[model samples]
Target: MPVAAKADVVVVGGGPGGFAAALQAARMGASVVLVEKFDMPGGVHTSGLQGAANEGVGGIHTELMARFEAAGYIYIATEETLPEWTGNPLSHYEKMKKPGDRFSRSSFNPEGAGSIMSAMLAEAGVEAMFGTAFLDVALNEYGDGIDAIIVANASGIQAIQGRIFIDGTGTSELVARAGAPFVRGGGPQPSGADWDGRHRPIPGGLLWTMSGVDFTKTAAHQKTAKDPTLAKLIAEADAAGDIPQGLYRPRMTGKGVYGEHYIGHPTLDMSPIEAPDSFILWQNVPYEWALHMDDDARDEARAKSALRGFIDAEAQFLRKYVPGFENAYLTNVGRYVGTRDGRHPLGEYIFSIDDAQQGRSFDDAVTSPMTKTFFWDGFKRHTFQVPYRCFLPKKIDNLLLTGASLSFSYETIFMVMRNFPWCTQTGEIAGFAAARSVEQGIGPKELQWDQPYF
Candidate 1:
């Protein structure tokens, strides 16, 4: 017989979504249990090596940033002072700003993010079980509520029961395990029909980071002059067949410090479930660079080969074309790929692209000002709300899901659902709702979607 421990609420998968859910539930006075496969929290933001938080979903999301700032973990990107150009105005005109300055967006350090998230979870006093994997969910005899969850840890399989459960797993593992209906790759399985009856898989994506950069020197180089050779090289690289067009953009995380160049490639079928560690690269290479490599050695070789190509190309560009980077080095790559789309649960409300574009605010809006979908493209911005119905499955009365796997359409996902902050916001709402439902002694489905909370 397994030891059964009960809690007011149970949250599985300790990523940003799970952590926020657990923290918010505990703060609301619920005895919450947060289970994570890893030893620490912050999911992609910490372990995955995804770069810093952005300013989108405010309120609780803003509070997370405050904690990081209060802990001396925040940094600002500053503009470089450019030197005066000589000769014709266009002849020696200086670039004035770093490559990342093409867009005005805030960025942060991953190390800082990890530190602050760990601190926040510790301060919240939520009972966290790290290095634990959720095996199966035991349903009530009526098949309406989740009676207990079986998890495998170092000790063995333990059955933990809770009045309410929140699934923060990006893959919706809990919801699927509980026998709830779900759709992977942007539509229903087998047919892949979306809400509007279109076919699409959840958009698969990747994120890589470059290191060995001299921030100060790069800033200086940008300010001193614009070299035509460098511009040509950039244009040439942009035209490369493997590189995704229009997805390459620079993001500065710190002032005269670290930065990132985002390359969004949708054709690469590197799903989170299939290639969790595929994003860590030592260099920037063609998207099909892994096609010929052996399956067993692909991951390792991809990192090395891609990184070498990236560094060498960058070095040549900086030395011969760009002004700075004469001594730039390749630093570290991301630990996990920055996934944009994945499997989502089938729920009562499937948020669509039309809803997102129209700025449709739900009557049961858990959080206000659900903004538009902000994808890799720098120019597009859309605001939309996440209805409470999206959190609960139509059939499952006890289980709730949040994060990237929430109920939404492929068009909606492509439009507004890809935002990470929105996922965090949804997570917070799901946690609060689950706790409230448990305290009220009602099935999660019974909670009014019109006005989620009294």
Candidate 2:
């Protein structure tokens, strides 16, 4: 097969990180080609139907949010904004208000946000090949650097050549295929702890949307109905085997901590402001299932099939049991399942969770020191800086890692720095570094972190 397209940078996966990398590289005057299996951009946030900007972010992410806000696609969740959409009196947020509440995230319309992202990529001159899946990669004669990547789409199998390649597939698919060293997620290990690869990874979830919900009725019932808290109803349903066996449940555990789950679904306002009557729901798979779903095709198919069944059950249960969901119906399902943990390509430096909590600074930080990000552990906020070394995958001269697959302890990516803005920041640095390396005619590892690449 002949090479379909050649560019300075070839990016696989057009999620937040991949899209940002392509856009930044193109803006910096490097010819770019980004391939995504989904038809649209904004990976988990768009195609996955989790259109959440969990926290305030800067750099390319800030720009993207600005665009969304301008397009009237964003919904900032807050104490004041909550009641408008659901008609429920804000109790939780009001009680837990803090000085750092300014950094809270906003939700948006997934389809609208995706279109805007596509437009941004095109405007930045990034040639995005949507609905394309990565097949294989061709290594240079020395077997040390990638030369071209094999991808399949409607046009059939083709090769895309580039000087530098970015593995933004979130799971580091490119890096793993190129024979680079990577670490698999080994379920809730401490920062920098060793893993034997025998354990399962963390749990993953699938998100879907339901439309035609009566938010006001739901809120009113939740506040005044006999089972006002929904605890009794959920318990009754669970006892009757109505709720899915493995679905996660949220709990209000004390003041600062709210347990280990997302607050929505059964109660609370998960509806996007664009459509107040629509609710976003998620079904989480247990770690035992997630381990197989990460890399095994057959297992993934099985898990996805099971998840769909769980989603249907949950929808039915909601309509039958929940007061506000009598007329609600499942509308859109995310094309991709959301994984909290998977393969992480090792880099020059593995950022640890301790680094995140302590607000550790690096001499070669790619992130601005003023950028405020937080981890969920007690909701601790920090001004963390990501080093440039984390983007450089070990044993790969021309390949860079981005997104959740970048060098970090599983805890770090899980607890913090895996949000939209952080991933985009990493992509911005990688794209800038890749373009700079190409222009300088040197490997990415040879570039000085402190030097001005631009």
Candidate 3:
């Protein structure tokens, strides 16, 4: 096959991780090429319509948020407002009607974020090949390093050669294709039965937004609306076939939404983003359907098709039943469903939940100690650190792992570190390591972990 391009580092899957990896490497004076399946970067945050960043400490994440704010592309809720709004519930309804505090917890315009990603990559002299899909890898003579990757795009099948490759595919697709060992079926199950694809991986969801919603009326109704009444409407919708079949229960995580059980009251479920009339929402699929992710492509496609059906049904139901959504319409649907967990390429160290809960630290730490922010309200908010060894594939000499594909066990730790900010941090570390490895004429594993690189 013809060689499409050559660079010092080649990054696959231009999501948050891959995008940061490519950008950082190029900025470090390495020739970089980033390949993405979609037309834009930002992965789930863009194409998947997951436009929110709940937490960010430093690094590219904070910088990106600053740019988004300057460009008028984001809505931010500060740390102080975060607690106050959660306390008063109705405060979110009022606050969201106006501008937010600053860029702490943020929701952005996905397209605008994508444009920013493109501009950053371009400015750093990185060749970003969007609309390109990874096909396979070409191994070197020793079978320990990748010489190039085979890809397909509108330009047809071609090869992208690089000295070092980073896999941010979120499913460890590159390492899997390179014949490296990885943990699958929700990571280190005891019965060994889950590895056979019998058990579901992490729960996956699809996000979409609706415009022309009346938040004022929705908030007023939420103040006195009874759960029994909303549940009855849902039952009626199901009876009338307005709701999708096979348990189409969706929950809201957007602005102006009150309480955790917003699923019971669909009117209070949608979260406002960018504008008061615009809101983002998501729905979790059945366990049987979620099990297909990264294992069976055909089945995954079927699951997505079912999700689209749910989106249509829910949109119609909101317009007909909800008081505030009398004329609500679907503003946009995500390009694809976002998978939370999948294949994890095994590394020298598999960061486990125990490590996270204990707030373990290592000499080879690549990331600053991060707080325990995922799902567990009761667990102590201890800080955990990620080491550089977690990014190195055990069998692949020239490949590094980032994003959800990193060598972390599936559980609370994955949920904590899998956010866009954390993923970008991992990418920053990996990119720096790859560029240094190329410059020093050594494998990534041989490099000494330097704290200043972070």
Q: What is the C-alpha RMSD of each candidate to the true structure, in Å?
A: 9.1, 4.3, 5.1
| Candidate 3: regions farther than 4 A off | 54-56, 77-105, 187-197, 223-225, 247-269, 288-290, 374-378
lDDT of each: 0.58, 0.74, 0.76
List model 3 lDDT by residue over 1-454, tens digit each.
9999999999999888999899889989999999999998899999988887554557888888888888899886544434223322333233343333332445899989899988999999999999999999999999999999999999999999999999989888999999999977454333332445575555576778988877556545545675322565678778997776654444433221111322222333345576656778776555434355776788678768877887787888889987678988898888887777778778999987678778898889986676665443333566888888999999889999988888887765345668888788888888999999988989898998868355
Extract clashing residue pairs from model 2.
Answer: none
Candidate 3, run of 10 with poorest lDDT: 254-263
* Superior by lDDT: candidate 1 or candidate 3: 3
For candidate 2, the lDDT comes to: 0.74
Q: Model 3: which residue pairs collide?
A: 254-271, 255-271, 255-272
Q: What is the lDDT of residue 120 in candidate 1?
A: 74
Model 2 per-residue lDDT tens digits across residues 1-454:
8799999999999888998999998998999999999899888889988877544466788888888889999876543434433223222222234422432336788999999999999999999999899989999888899999999999899999999999888888898899989887664443322235355565566888888877567656766765545666678788988887654344323322123343223433244434656667666664434345567788677768887987888788779888778998999888977777788778999888677777888888886563444444656666667788889888879998888879887766773667777788778888888888878988889988884221
* Alpha-carbon runs more than 4 Å astray in model 1: 81-105, 186-212, 215-331, 358-361, 369-384, 449-454
lDDT of 1 by residue, 213-322 (tens): 34345435435555322344466555654233323333223211011122222111111111111112222233222222211246436545554454445445444444
Q: CA lDDT of 275 in candidate 1?
A: 18
